[model samples]
Target: MAAIIAADHVSKWYGQVIGLNDVTLTVPPGITGLLGPNGAGKSTFMKLVTGQLKASKGAVTVLGEPIWGNPSLYFRIGFCPEQDAFYDRMTGLEWVTALVRLNGATEAEAAAMANRALDYVDLADAAGKKIGAYSKGMRQRVKMAQALAHDPELLILDEPLGGMDPIARRKTIRLIKEWGRSGKSVLVSSHILHEIESMTSNILLVNQGRILAEGNIHQIRDLIDEHPHTVYVKADQTRALARAFLSEDDVLSMKFEDGAVIVQTARPDTFYARLTALAASGELGAIHEVTSPDDNLQAVFEYLVKS
Candidate 1:
């Protein structure tokens, strides 16, 4: 597959501080989650791609054209920034229409595009309301609407789900997923791993202004599979179960606490499945709760960032 965006030895700095260091990457079509905590240079990378800022060294190309200072690229790319800046007094329709017009669309075309973008974001009913009166979620959706107004080939969403309610976040995730499936290249950035996890398994992990890892999340999961996962199990039998788990090769370590057992294992799903089967078959009785430390993205990211 042809890469929509490519970076080679991309390095950026703000005087004494580094933003991205010797980073090289290729972003293919479909949804790619930009995974990193705050100050991880994710924003810098986005700016580099959108031509918002020039790279201190190296180069970035979007759609085979260098992104820096290229006005024409704006027609083929849409950006939803992390900042919450919006026209407080202007209605959503007015704001989006204004941006669409700035993209070189005629008044009628801009209005039609604005309406379609508003509808896509489920903000058509609130299009006439002042942005100041809109809720945070509404504001987020408005930002998304503005990004979608131009109908760009690439959608770069930086923390699009921030400040949204869970239901709204879910809807946004679904929307991005559908867009990716429909052949649009969607690159979304979020510090929250579960948010990125729910959107797409393809991730570009960044930390401390560098790319820590990139590729399928399951592959990264496999990379960390060797590390023992702390699985907490609360059951009626504590010592007996702990003893049983200690005898198994899959269970690397075990500890007893509060009438429950915390077992460390390399394969959580396998261990969990076996444990459940044992309990179901009247071998291990009365299991209550089972939780794995490696099941969440935060833990996995922490490990990778440290590595």
Candidate 2:
């Protein structure tokens, strides 16, 4: 797939301060999660891609055109910034319609688009409510509405899930997946690992202004050998499995759950190998399923950032 956003040796500095280092990446069409903690240059990269900041070195292009100072390219791009800035006095309907008008839609067309976007975000009922009166979550929905109202090819969202409730978060995650399935590209940035993880398996892990890792979350977690990996297994004979697992010295501990066992081991490969052999013997009954619960961005962060 061709890249919608491309950055090669891109760096950004605020005077003597560095916001991003020599970071190179290509974002193809689809939903790609930008995973990193705060102050990790995620925002800086978003700004550069959205044409909000000029790169200090190298180049950045979106849709085969330079991002810097190219206001026209924004017609094909939708941006939801990290900040909470808003027109306090304007209603959600007014605010979203104003933004849609920037896309050259007629007032009537913009109003219709605004309503459609508000409905997509499940905020149609509150479209007439003033921004100052709306809760943080509602305001976030308004921001989302404006981004989708234009129906851009690429949606660039910065910490969009911040301040959302669990239900709203789930809805937003589903929305992102829906957008990707519709064949549009989305670049979403979040400091929370699980938040990004729920949105897409494809991730760009950034830390200290550099691209640290990219690809499946589990693949990245596998690279961290310093921590114990936790795997959950469901089996017909739980007691038999526990007895066998407890004998393995490499397994640090074991926890019993309803019809399942959670095992922590420093050597995952050996543990998996043993499980395969034991399952083949039929002494432990049938092993229904095996999964690594911590095979995610949290494991990678615990190793890369927390360690």
Candidate 3:
């Protein structure tokens, strides 16, 4: 499949500070998560993709056309930025209608589109409510409504799930999945690992203004597993559990804390299999829980950067 967005040696800097540093990437169709920490140049990259800001060097193209200085391309792209900027006095319907009208939609057509969008986001009842009166979640949905009102081919959402409650978050995630399933492309950026995990396995990891890694999350996790992994096991007999793994060659070290056995192993797959067998054998006391503090996106990014 052709890439929906592409960058070649793209770099963006603001005066003395660097936002992106010689980054190159291609985002395919369907939903791709832009995973990175704050100040990781996610916003800068998204801005370049959306044509909100020009790259300091190199090229950025979306849907086979250069994004910068391309006014007509805006109609095909929907952007829900992280920052909140709304007309507090205007109703949701009015706010979305105004945005759609800017896309050359007729007044009546804009209103109809706005209504449908509001309904899709489950905000039809609040369409007549003033923006100032809506909750944080409602405001987020309203921004999404405006983005969808124009029926763009690609959606560039930056932290769209932020500030939303559990129900609203799930609903918005479903909507994003639905959009991708409909054959549209979505570049959704978020710092939360599980959020992106639930939406799509395809991800691009960014850190310190550079692309660290990009691929399926499972593939990335497998790469990360090459490094030492620390797993914590809480059980009634921590000492017994620790002793059981002491003979294993892959077990690097062990420690005890708060009635939990913390084991460091170079081969976590082997360690986990042994642990599961021991638990099933009923030799060790009841095992409460098992967790790996290092098994997360942030840790994975750190490992990638250091490697």
lDDT of 3: 0.85
lDDT of 3 by residue, 274-301 (tens): 7767766777876655655524446667
Q: What TM-score do all the candidates reach, one by one?
A: 0.75, 0.75, 0.75
**How does residue 84 of candidate 3 score in lDDT?**
78
| Model 1 quality (TM-score) | 0.75
Please give the TM-score that candidate 3 achieves against the real structure: 0.75
Listed per model in order, the count of residue pairs whose N, CA or C atoms clash below 3 Å is 0, 0, 0
Q: Which regions of candidate 3 are displaced past 4 Å? A: 219-300, 303-307
Q: What TM-score does structure 2 among the candidates reach?
A: 0.75
How high is the lDDT of residue 149 in model 2?
96
Report the Cα RMSD per candidate.
9.5, 10.3, 9.4
| Model 1 CA lDDT for position 193 | 56
